[model samples]
Target: MARYAILVRGINVGTAKRVAMADLRAVLEESGFSAVRTHLNSGNAVGTGNDGLDPAEAGARVEEALAARTGVSARTLVLTAGQLRTIAAGLPYAAEMAAVEKAGSRMMAHVLFADPDPALLAEHDLTAIDPGNVQLGERVVYQWCPNGLLESPDVSGWITKNLHVEVTTRNWNTIAKLADLL
Candidate 1:
């Protein structure tokens, strides 16, 4: 069995895309995922499944199920437990304890598809990110958008609008919990 963290985008935002976490958990359980757990109301789920099922397919199934039940289409990003662990271990902010402390805030790491082109990273102006910070990694981008998540520029929105890759974000707390889950 493989453990996976599934992120469902555009749910529970404003009046649109509303999905109950309980219903999501039920859908995953019905879909044959074991040890299923949800984090917050933002559509983050940790579950384990048999080796026969593909992770991407599982994600799509879950998205479809959620949309069919809730009348909203969700973009799902699926990552193995190991992949999430690697992302947590490679966090640049972990080494800069002082800067992290002084920032008096938390950070979020956005997992993006691996791309070699520099243009993909430069698509968004760094200055517009505000007190929010951004760092491009080999397969992810670290964002420190501290003025609360909704207030900050939607990094996922910008990336999707400008880049041709899939991206999903998790806050520091979510990352830490995911590490614990792994």
Candidate 2:
């Protein structure tokens, strides 16, 4: 079996694509996944499944199972344990971005499906961010926009709303915690 982290987008937000974690787990288990566990309620799951399936195939299977159970289509992203570890290690903002020790402040890394097109990164007006704090990696982009994630224009709704790519974000703290889970 191979371990994977599966993230489903657009779930439990303003009542669209609502999938209870229990139901999601049931579907995954029914589809032959083992050691299933969910994080929070935003459709993040860490589990073990058949080794032969790739992330894309695992995502498709999860989506199909979820739609069958909840009657809502979901966009999913799956990362293997090794891939997740690589992403955690490759975070660009780890050294440059200051840590926020406050209760709700978040330090996050957004995992992109592919290395962003260099042309797109070049075109984005990144002048608003501290040049030293931003690190662009092969499949991850790290930004230490501290004052709460919503406050940073560089890491806010704009990137997710405008960029035509699939991204799944996890706070630095969450990344560390999940590493232990693996």
Candidate 3:
């Protein structure tokens, strides 16, 4: 059995797209996942499954089960525990650590469901993204929002608008916690 971290996007944010973590855990467990656990109310789950499902297949199962259980359409990204640890360790903040220390910026990361297109970054006018505030990873993008994500609407919006891919973001602190959970 392999342990996986499942991230559900755009849920439990407001009145719409609400998905209780308990319900999600139950659905996943019922679908053959073992040791299912949830973190917070944002739909982060860690579980061990013996179904031999790949990340993509696990994500599809989670989405299908979620809709069947709660009638909410959610985009789920499934990553092995190792993948989550790699993403946590490979955060692109070392080069900007000093700058962030001086500016007290808040670091954030957006893990994309699919590999981003090579030309997507260049295709989107990135003048709005502050220098050293954005870095692209193997399958995730890191952004250092100096004034928090809520304060940087353009940068947040540009991620989904230009990438044309499903993504779920977590603050650096939360990313570390999730990695530790794995």
C-alpha lDDT values of all predictions: 0.72, 0.71, 0.78
Better of 1 and 3 by TM-score: 3
Ranking by TM-score: 3, 2, 1
Stretches > 4 Å off in candidate 3: 94-105, 121-128
| TM-score per candidate, chains pooled | 0.78, 0.81, 0.85
Cα RMSD to native, each candidate? Answer: 3.5, 2.9, 3.0
* Clash count, predicted structure 3: 0
User: 20-86, model 3: which lDDT tens digit per residue?
Assistant: 8889998788666888888889888888976467889878888899999999998888988888988
Question: lDDT score, residue 56, model 1?
Answer: 76
Of models 1 and 3, which has the larger lDDT? 3
Candidate 2 weakest ten by summed lDDT: 96-105
The better-scoring model by lDDT among 2 and 3 is: 3
Stretches of model 2 off by over 4 angstroms after superposition:
95-99, 102-105, 118-132, 154-163
Q: Candidate 1: lDDT of 47?
A: 92
Could you give candidate 2's per-residue lDDT for residues 59-172 as a string of tens digits? 888789888898979878788888788877776654444444542235666777655556766777543454544566556666676566776655534355444457777777
Q: What is candidate 3's TM-score against the reference? A: 0.85
Q: Which pairs clash inside model 3?
A: none
Residues 125-160, candidate 1: write the lDDT tens digits. Answer: 643655436666656777765555666777766666
Top candidate (lDDT): 3
